[model samples]
Target: MNRLTIYTLFSLFLFTNCNENAAEKSLFSASKSPNTAQNIILLIGDGMGISQITAGMYASDSILNLERFKSIGLQKTDAANHLVTDSAAGATAFATGKKTNNGVVGMDAQLKSAKNIIEYVKEKGLAAGLVATSQIAHATPAAFFAHHPKRAKMENIAAQLLTTDVDLLIGGGQNHFEARKDNRNISKELAQKGYQVNSFMTKSLDKIEPNYKDNFLYFTAASLPLSVEQGRDYLPLATSFSIDFLKKHNSNGFFLMVESSQIDWGGHNNNSDYIIQEMLDFDKVIGRALDFAEADGNTLVIVTSDHETGGYSINYGSSRKKFKTGFTTDYHTAQMVPVFAYGPNEESFMGIYDNTDIFKKMMETFGIEK
Candidate 1:
C-alpha cells in the first residue's frame, strides 16, 4: 500500500479504538460530541442536601421526581474567599463559571463583570426565562440575569431587568418594581417597553395568560412569596408556562431556570417540616421540567443546588411514615452537593467536579463558546 492509504488506515484504527475506550467509560466520559441540545432546563433546589432529599422522599411515600435521572455527580461548593458559601457566591459560580465572594452577584471577586449564560446565549438569538418561588430579584434568580455588587440591592437588580431581553419571568418582588427605594416605578417602564407586567395584586397566576408578542412578567407576591405549606404552589405551573412562552418567543432554542427558593429558608429556620414541604414542592417542579424535556427530546435537564444548608442529617428509627432529623448549623455548610442531569449529553455530568464546571458543561452542551 502507498503512504496515503497507510495514513488513512492508521487514522481509522485510532478513531475506532478511541470510541471503544469512551464506550467502556460511558458513565464518566467527557468526550465532546456533535450533538447539541436545543434547550436547557436547569432546576435548582436551593439548600437541598442529601438528608433533606431523603426526608422528602420518605414524606412523599418513598417517591421523588429526581429518581428519573440516571446520570448523577457530586460538586464541591465553596466560595472564593471562604470555605463555606452563601447563595450569592454559589450561584455566581454556576452563572459565570467563576467563584466570587459571598453576597456578590454576577461579578467576580475583583468586581469585574462576567457575561452570564443567558446574556451570552442571547447574542445567538436564543430566548431565556426564569421561575422562582422567591422574589424575582432574589440572589439565586437574580444571578441568572442581573449583575450587582451585592445581592441585597433588590431595587437596582429590579431596574437592571430593563436592560435584558429575557422573554419570560414568573416570580415575586412587586415591591421592587412598583414600590422601590429610589421611588421609580419600573413596572410602568416595563409596560412602556411593551412588556406585559402583571402581579398577584391584579390577577392570580392561573388567570394571567402571557401574550407571546410582548415579554411576560408576573409577580406572585408584593414581596417575598409564602412557603409551600402556606398554600403557595405556583412553581410547577410557572415552570410549565415559562417553557411554553420561551419556546414560542424563540423557535431556535431557549434557556429556563426554575428555583425552589424557600428550601434554604427552611434550613435557616432549622425546621424539618418546612424543608420537607418545600422539597416535595420542588420535586413537583422537577417533574414538570422533566415532562417538557422528555417531550421535546432536544432539551437538556439539570437538577442541582449551590450548597447544602443546615448540615442536615437523618436519625435512626426513621420510617416512611415519620422521621427524626438533626442540623449541625442553622446556616449553609461546606458540603459537596449532588448534580443530576438528563436528556442529551447527560453523561457529561456523571463524575465529581467543581460547581463551575456545571456552567461550562451547559455551555458545551448547547455548543456555545465560553
Candidate 2:
C-alpha cells in the first residue's frame, strides 16, 4: 500500500476506537440507577474511626460486615465553629444538612430549628425511628428529632422527642421521660398519645413481641446502658426486629437511624476493652442490618461515624485477636470518617464530602423534592 493510504487508514482506526470508548462510557453513565430505595437504614457508629474498625476486625479474628460494602467514602466532620465536632454538631450535620456549632442538635448554626430526616419522612406518612445504645435523648439520636441550642439539656430534648411523630424509639433514657422535675409523666403522656411505651423493668426485649399496629416505645435502660460485656446485647435484635416492624408500620416505607452510641463512650473513656467490645457489637448490628438489606433488596444501608474519637490507633506488636491499642485523647479528634453504603443509590455516596452532604444524599435517595 502507499504511505498516504496507510496513514489515513491508521488515523481512521484510532478515531473509531476512541468514539466507541466514549459511547460506552456515556452508556454506562446513563445506565446508572435512579433513586429507588423504599427504605433507608442509616447506621452511625459514634466515635468509630478507621483504627477502631481495624481493631475490631483484628480482635474479632473475623471479617466485619463493613468489609462487604463496595461503595465507601469519607466525610468531613467539622462543626461550624470548631474543627473537632461534638456528637451533637456532627450528627446535626447528618440529620439536617447544616454545619451547626458544637452542642447544637436538630438546629442550624443560627440556632434555628432544622427539619431533620425523621421529621421530614414522618410528615410524608413514612415510619421514622431512633435506635441508640445511649439514651435516646443523647447527642447523636436526639439530633434526628429534637432541636435545641444545647444538646446536654436532656429533659428538653426528651420533651421535643414527644413532638417529633417518630414511630419507634428503642434505647435508654426512660427516666428522662417519666422522672422529670416538671411533674409531667412523659411516659404516661406518650401513652396518652397512643404510644405503646414499655421498659426493661417490665420485660426483656427478646421476649417482647412487637405489635406493629401502634407506635412502639421500648426503653432498654433507665439511663445509660451497659457495655456489651455487661450483657447489653439488644442492638442487633432491636435493629432486626425494628426493620420488620417498621416495614409493617408504614406502607410508604421507613427511615431508621441506628446509632451504636457506646463506641464513642469507650473512646471517651480511653478504655481499649470497652472500645473493642462496643466496636464488635456495632459490627454485629451492621451484619444484621446488611442481612435485612440483602434479603429485602430495596433497603439502602449507610454505615458511618459522626467523628473519630480518642485519636485511636493500633500500635506495634498487635496480633490477630489481640491488639496493642493507643489513644492520644479522650475526646473526638479532627478526623474525617468513612461512610459505607450498600443497595439502591449507593453510588451517590462514593466520594469524599461534608457531613451535611449525608443528609442531602439521604433526602435525594428518598426521592424527596428540594
List, residue by residue over 281-351, the lDDT tens digit for candidate 2: 99999999998887766678999999999999988998887778899999999998999999888988999
- Tens digit of lDDT per residue, candidate 1, span 1-370? 9999999999999888677742243322323442478789999989998888888888896569999999999999899999999999888898899899999889899988878999988998898998888998999988888888899999999899899877888888889998877889998998899889888887987888678889898989989899988999899888888888898877878989889998899999999999999999999989999988776677899999999989988898877748788899999998899999998889999989999898999999888886
Pairs with backbone N, CA or C atoms under 3 Å apart (clashes), candidate 1: none
Model 1 residue 77 distance off true place after TM-score fit, in angstroms? 0.9
Residue 288 in candidate 1, Cα distance off native in Å: 0.9
Pairs that collide, model 2: none
Instruction: List, in order, the clash count of every candidate structure.
Output: 0, 0
Name the runs in model 1 displaced over 4 angstroms.
1-34
Q: After superposition, how far is residue 282 of candidate 2 from its true place, in Å?
A: 0.7
Reference-based lDDT, each prediction = 0.87, 0.89
* TM-scores for all predictions: 0.90, 0.90
TM-score of 2: 0.90
Worst 10 residues of 2 by lDDT: 22-31
